[model samples]
Target: MSERSFEGKAVLVTGGSRGIGAAVARRFGSLGAHVAVGYRSGRDAAEALCAEIGAAGGTAVAVAGDVAVPAQAQAMVGRAHDAFGRLDVLVNAAGVGPYLPLAEIDEAHCRAIFDTNVLGTIMLTQAAAPLLPSPGGRIVHFASRLAFNPLPTSSVYSASKAAVVTLVHGFARELGPRGITVNAVAPGVIETDMTADILRERGEQILAATPLRRIGQPDDVAGVVTFLASADAGWVTGRTIIADGGLN
Candidate 1:
């Protein structure tokens, strides 16, 4: 609604160099939120995003860390507070997807995906939760439609996201008494670099199943994430809002 609704708020977005994460960073920054874009790699893109936000008169800083590591996750939050004043919203958009069939899914691959999608979320949330302001502090994690659909070769990824939704529900209950809200956004078949090939192959089938009959954009999901992290969503907590265009 208002352009400066997030004025004075500070947000940390992980994996914010590109795709949905990048869109989320821009959306929050544009709304007057001081943004910290956290990236594991893709330094150039992360810097560019920070520059773009700065050009738009939004405060932003780029921080690099591997979400898979708890220390790194904490450092990312530390940098955000060091740059801005404190953290208001934490968006766990850092995740990894490995498209391997259930039978072929190796322990190493599964561990890698879970490390980023689940454990990383836990670590980041634990690090930022205390720093968040009580009344309207928010935490939003990115789950996936795959959690429900059980796609052909995404066993590990789907399981990890399912865990994320559970984590949201549990943390919301744990943090509710403290006045901090925890929630999640589950996206389906968004048109991002991660879904390029799937979009090319099963695009028709996916579109047909989606009542909206269209592939979603990163911004489509980002808008919902910003709402979840804002004061407007103060009453909502623990639930995972599905942004799948009716695919699920």
Candidate 2:
């Protein structure tokens, strides 16, 4: 394992049933990595993805867990580690982003957003830090371009992702000595099931604002996530690579 080829590496991707997380999982599977497709309620979709990866000559399995729960978070990591015998990468793509005006923000809304986006990320990293290989451990969290440039009704959601960026900064410093790299990929409006409404309502506005003149796809962000997990990005940490086609 001196060279640490991308093949045979074990990767756990939370919220991987559909959307950006699914794209990241598929990317790793295509690279010959053993993928743990972690999902909350989309068991069927997760299992389907696993089958797809397997059909394509890669290894994958669907693991169910709610990342916001500390016990569940720990179990998710443990499950992936037990399955592969060694964990090399952890991608915390489990998150929620529901835009609400400040006046409409309720305790439940705040809790739901932060519990998944902020706390889930921290809990997963905490569980993964010890198991990940020292020289090759990789952790990538899902942040958002809104964290830096918030939209009108995105206060709570934006704040949650902002917390992810700060976590990367703190975790990168703490985990550097062990040779693990922690980073975030803050993607712009990626076309996914979760963002279908936003796309339908604000399609024109978003397109005009985006330099690329098109909404981002999951694979677009997946590429950046895989790079951050690769040996090529060993020296990169504590940074949020905004994958917005230069929207930020």
Candidate 3:
């Protein structure tokens, strides 16, 4: 791909301060796209990422918002649109995964998971839809392998992700008339702060099950996300690409 393949395009990545979100933002910036790194609390980290992208001769800005809130989601999208003059891609990487067994899963726990993972994705997509250019906008959502291959103590997280995949399918059909493509990526056991504790607790079993015999890196997921946002993926929509290294 050309270094400037994404030139003139603007991307908004939620939870872009760290982990897979950060990697996605960096990849888009590296490809000559203007990036808006949206964060909930990691202000310093988000700013640092923006600086790093800037140092690499790319355009990036850090925007703060809590994705679970409708107003905040709208503001984040508005800020990115105002800053870049246009929005081409929206990556919903902001999510929360809390492992709770069915016996212990309560309404509060379920609400928290759904609000952040499902509702957040919906709100952001709603807010960005008007700003996205017609006939070529892209929407990439973050799902998880657990959505398909569920495990114990992850009922809420798994269900929320399953909802995300369904939402992507519905949105793809609704948004297809506008020329916008919607898709989701299901990443399995990536090496990020979010998965550090889990890896320490179940790394051996997880690695043994994975055909690759190793944990995935954030960039492994980010690369697929970048491709989904590229023009080459124009014909693809309403599908979830699994990035689990054959763990299933």
lDDT winner: 3
Among all windows of 10 consecutive residues in model 2, the one with the lowest summed lDDT is 1-10
Q: Estimate each model's TM-score.
A: 0.98, 0.97, 0.98
Ranking by lDDT: 3, 2, 1
lDDT of 2: 0.92
Query: lDDT of all the models against the reference?
Result: 0.92, 0.92, 0.93
> Which residue pairs come into collision in candidate 3?
none
Name the candidate, 1 or 2, with the larger lDDT value: 2
In candidate 1, what are the lDDT values of residues 7-115, reduced to their tens digit? 9889999999999999999999999999999999889999999999999999999999999999999999999988888899999899888699778878899889989
Task: State how far residue 155 of model 2 sits from its true place (Å).
Answer: 0.4
In model 1, what lDDT does residue 139 have? 97
Q: Model 3 off-target regions past 4 Å? A: none
Ranking by TM-score: 3, 1, 2
Q: Residue 31's C-alpha lDDT in candidate 1? A: 97
Clash pairs, model 1 backbone: none
Error of 1 at 159 (Å): 0.7
Lowest lDDT sum, 10 consecutive residues, model 3, at: 96-105
Across 1-248, the per-residue lDDT of candidate 3 in tens digits comes to 67788998999999999999999999999999999999999999999999999999999999999998889999999999999999999999998987988889899998889999999999999998888889999999999999997889987899999999999999999999999999999999999988888999989998998998889998989889999999999999999999989885
